[model samples]
Target: MKRIAILNCLKANDVCAGAACLKAFNSRSRHFEQYGAEPIELVAMGRCNGCEVGIDEGFQEKLDRIIEEGAEVCHLGVCTIKSETRQECKTITEAANYLETHGVQIVRGTH
Candidate 1:
């Protein structure tokens, strides 16, 4: 099975329960279509620190957990890519870079 992780926008966490992302992953639709019917394991789900701080505070711990879980790939949720501010965009970039540096492939969107 392919291990996967999902990173969402911190601000959106309050209202978004991630149903869409999970549905897409479970059905192998949208950005997850590449996986086809291959077995997939969702190893982690986390959110960015927030636009003000980006990925600065406590993000390493989260990343460590994700890596420890054996996630080979990370999908940045749609909320992350559609961030409302430039700072949020930067946070998403930093999160993606951090994941990549640790050997996880980055997928721009989850659904």
Candidate 2:
């Protein structure tokens, strides 16, 4: 079975001003587990951490840790982008391809 992680780019509290992020995270968490993947590990960091800007050592460290342990995919909280600008569904789609090329699939929310 492949391990799956939830990708997020905000501090835990920032995930909620409303409820979209929480819903998306939980929904995907359950979905992946049902499909025989590891329960999603939320990869969140502080606002100062800039996880949204792209790769950083701290964030990369976490990703590396998961990947090293053989995480085969990441199911993003689709609503994450909704909560933020750069609704890069296009950038995200491209990123998914990139991640898959590196042998780690990046999936979107099912619900």
Candidate 3:
């Protein structure tokens, strides 16, 4: 199985219901339709802690859980990519970099 995950933006957590992402994957939209013949397993779905003074300490814990779950792909929600603030951008970049270093493929958008 190709383990996957969805990472959401904390700032837009209230606004984004995550329906689109789920719908896209559940329906096997183009974004995921060609993920080889192997079944894709959604192992994690979570949001960033928030772009504050710095990333939350628990952020590492969350990522650890995903990695432990054998997640090989992480689809970042559009909210994270379409963030309006620079802090959010930085947070996303940092998190993406971390995920990459840990061997997780980072898909820029989720639905």
**Which scores better on TM-score, 1 or 3?**
1
Provide the global lDDT of candidate 2 against the true structure.
0.51
The lDDT values for all models are 0.86, 0.51, 0.82
**Regions more than 4 Å wrong, model 3:** 83-88
Ranking by lDDT: 1, 3, 2
| Model 1, span 18-56: residue lDDT tens | 999999998999999999878999999988788787667
Give the clashing pairs for model 1.
none
Q: Which RMSD values do the candidates have, in order?
A: 2.0, 5.4, 2.3
With a 3 Å backbone cut-off (N, CA, C), the pairs that clash in candidate 3 are: none
Error of 1 at 107 (Å): 0.3
lDDT of 3 by residue, 1-111 (tens): 889998898877777887898888877784776675668889999998987834677988888888888899998887886545524377878888888899999988766
Instruction: Give the TM-scores of the predictions, in the order they appear.
Output: 0.89, 0.53, 0.87
Tens-digit per-residue lDDT, 11-82, candidate 2: 444544524544644564344445543445544312213435555566556555656666576666544465
The superposed Cα distance between candidate 2 and the true structure at residue 81, in angstroms, equals: 1.2
Error of 3 at 97 (Å): 0.9
lDDT of 3 at 109: 76
Whole-model alpha-carbon lDDT for candidate 1 = 0.86
Deviation in Å, model 2, residue 52 alpha carbon: 7.0
